[model samples]
Target: MSAGTQRMRAAVWYGAKDVRIAEMDIPAAGRGEVLIEVAFSGICGSDLHEYADGPHAIPVAEPHPASGARAPLVLGHEFCGTVVELGPSVTGLTRGDRVAVEPNYRCGRCPRCRAGEYNICRHFGFAGLMGNGGMAEYAAVPAYMAHRLPENVSLEQAALFEPASVALHALRRAGTTPGTVMVVGLGPVGLLTVRLAAEREVPRIVAVDVSPARLHRASALGATDLIDARLGEGVGERIRELTGGEGVDVAFEVVGSESTLRTCLDATRRGGRVVLVGLAQEMSLDSFALVNNEQSIIASVGYRDTYPELIRLVAERGLDLTPLVTSTIALDTLVPDGFEALLDGPGDQIKILVDLAARSDRLGSPEASAGTRRVRPQPGGGEPETSE
Candidate 1:
């Protein structure tokens, strides 16, 4: 069948709080691309940002330098699917291959791209935010971005590779080795960071969050210590108490807020490293404290070439990420049961997956809908904030 003649259901984003489930023509794979029959697509934290206060990364006025895509684009970056068609000149992959989409756009000719740092290329954007993506039944992506999955890795587990890669990259950037580490958030990325840290055999793993459920999950994932941020005691103070008033060797700030950033800085030793993994708005920093301590503040963004290591961790080393997925809803509930559920009740969710193949009735019943509940906001709450 001709690509133009086939239609698929996609979640199209027009603007903030404006996403529609429309039938869009299936996109054809261009040269060096592959058309994938999507199985599962994850609603990322970036999607939440776009849904609430948006156009942050979505191109609207002018075309993006890389993808040249504008508004009304398909919305989903974390997805896994089976290759259905291979475009001309595409190599190393055949039809029926199950793979995870990397979903990054980069200007290959740029210095950063040439230097193998394509994730930070001069003009870099995500496929879902800046262009059409896998929030649909079928998505055409660059063949190079599709990483083949092993026999042990299911498509559902593969949907989380993108965020897992982010966590892995942040750890790599921090030069995390055997030492005391503290994760300042219980979000997906934060929890993944703890899991990775535990796997790496870090001597101490301290997890901080406002939600008891997330805290307990972190402990199960290998956190040696847990701190409830909702308690009147300050996070930095609590961290110090745990570290014998010396502070952790490395602190990861995954909350992306001014207060959380400060807590990370305060919780790190004088010469320890503080890694910023979250996306934060413009906020003031204490230059005096930063310079006086002679500490280093490392910032980590989207990953680069991290899929192989993550796949090995999951496939070979038996790293299990399935526990992080708390709920799965159909595309029809992408808004109410997916996005709004996460926003209104951040503490109640970890990761919500969109089962593209499922019908609306999968979660349409009122009894099923009641599972989506909201939690009251607490000061220094341990909501599952995303660092995606």
Candidate 2:
């Protein structure tokens, strides 16, 4: 079939709370790009933010400097797929190669990009947010963004590599070691933080969250202490109590709220570091306390050159990521079952994946038999008892 005539289903973002599953012409892989048949696309916190209150990153008034993509585009960055076609000049990849999409777009000439820190490029944008993304039957992404996966890592597990990279990058940015650490959010990234910190054998891991289920999950993932934020007890004070008044050597604020930011700052020791991993807008800071404590606040954005190492961690090191994936749904139910589900019951779900193949089977497509499948989390080490 001709590319222009081939129609694919996509979840297009029009505006806040307005995402339509429409049939659009399949995109052709341009120079240095690859066309992929999307397997699974996971709903991200950023996607939820865009759904709740946005145009935050989706450019509407003007074109983004990097991807030059605007709204009315597909909305998914965390995804994995199989290569269907290779674009001109694309090398080192071939058809049938299973890969995870990195989805980051940056201007190569930017100062940060030139300095090997493309994650914070001056004209930084993401493929799913700024342009077309993987929330469709097929997506064409830059070849460099596609990281070939190991045979052991299922596509469903690979779908989570993006957020896992975020957690890994945050931990690396904080220079985490065998020390007391506090994670002030029990979302996917926060839970992943606990898991990775446990892998690193951080001596004391304090997990703070409002949900008892999430806190229990943290404990199973290796948190030494759990603090319930819903009880109205001061998180900072509780953290202090857990640390015997010395405060944690490092803290991670993953909630992206003013109060959580303050809690992280107050929970950190005098010379400790607080890594800001969440996206927030116009938050007030306690400058006096910050100065008095001589504490450092380090901000970590999207990952850079992390896919290779992350792949090894999962493939070679036996690092299990299935615990973070709480449920999976078809693309047609993305709004209600994926977006609205996360918003309505934020504590109950961690990651909701859109199984394109399930929808394909329902549509009775020729590829239905060969549709992508989900890998169940193996028993032990914080794996949830049940998943859809």
Candidate 3:
């Protein structure tokens, strides 16, 4: 690592099943950009999909149809960091302030951004997905994307703002404000949705999951009712009975399975709103039945301008995600161990954080691991070193 050039390390996604930790020089914050020393980075479901499959968020091999980012991208978006450096001419920000990053780098000049709907920006891309992300020691992000973290929140907790915003956006899309709510899928986002929905003044949250362990977590988080999908074939029947046949007013689908999508739609009341926040291969629905029932189905995409509200709400007492946090590891464990844990046993696990400064015996110094170095085709002939 050069003294003048701080080479930061990050989990580089080369391709499907080919993720390696690579070192890149600490990037200079361009105009309107701020450099952050990442404190913690959380993993999301989409990240898992990218790990197991291809066509990752913010396309790499091909320019993202939307974000315009190409392959060999750094993989991380759910993270929180502190501003250590600011770009020239940037204002209203400073050093040493804790903050959460809203990863989507939308072309601010686009029609959607002009209309304040940047999530659907004609050109949208998230930090870790679209550009270099917080999986590294230092990340250069847009100044507008950073939100100040409250004093009471820990770095790990603030990292959740990304996923929490995803759920909040889903709820906001469903008009899920201050009322009865149903969250199907007990993963990180589902649990965060419950916690945030409570802060929104929703009196009851009924959670459904296939894992009993998740149901227990939901109960601890104030879920009034828990349904174990593994033991029952009639989940819709159970939900209807639990709600006294009125059915839930709003349902959030966080499980990325076709069946869960159908279940979410079925669990909502005739006139209720259902927010489809999950990403799955396919879902079959009868158009006539959906229209005739007057059911409002909303497909909430990535968060727009909602990180500040999430930070504020999370700092409040109503939504405390501290308990939902499951574990914390260093960045070196991200590709090898962290990804394994997330895939093998994410049941009941709400959030996992990668701490930047907390180096363990497990994570070696940046240059010590030859195992993480990459070998690539040299020019037009042999392979070459791709890392420090």
RMSD of each: 8.1, 8.9, 3.4
Best-first order by lDDT: 1, 2, 3
Scored against the true structure, residue 181 in model 2 reaches a CA lDDT of: 94
Query: Which candidate number maximizes TM-score?
Result: 1
Residue by residue across 1-388, what tens digits does model 2's lDDT show? Answer: 3445577878877788877676666888999999999999999998998988898889988888877777667899999999998999999999999999999987789788899999998888888899899999999998989999989988988998889889989999998384899999989999989998998899889999999999999999999999999755488987888778989999999989898988998889998999999878879998999999999999998899889988888899988888878898888677767778788874688888989877533433323212111222244623212222
Where does model 1 exceed 4 Å of error? 1-5, 362-388
**Please, what are the lDDT tens digits per residue for candidate 3 over residues 114-206?**
999989888777777767788878888889888887788777678878888887888788763635688998888888777777667688799
Better of 1 and 2 by lDDT: 1
Q: Which pairs, if any, clash in model 2? A: none
Residue 361, model 2: lDDT of 33
Residue 283 shift from truth in candidate 3, angstroms: 1.4
Query: lDDT tens digits, residues 117-167, model 1?
Result: 999999988889988888888999888889999888898889999888888
lDDT score for candidate 2 against the true structure: 0.85
Error of 3 at 263 (Å): 1.7
Cα error, residue 222 of model 1, in Å, equals 1.1
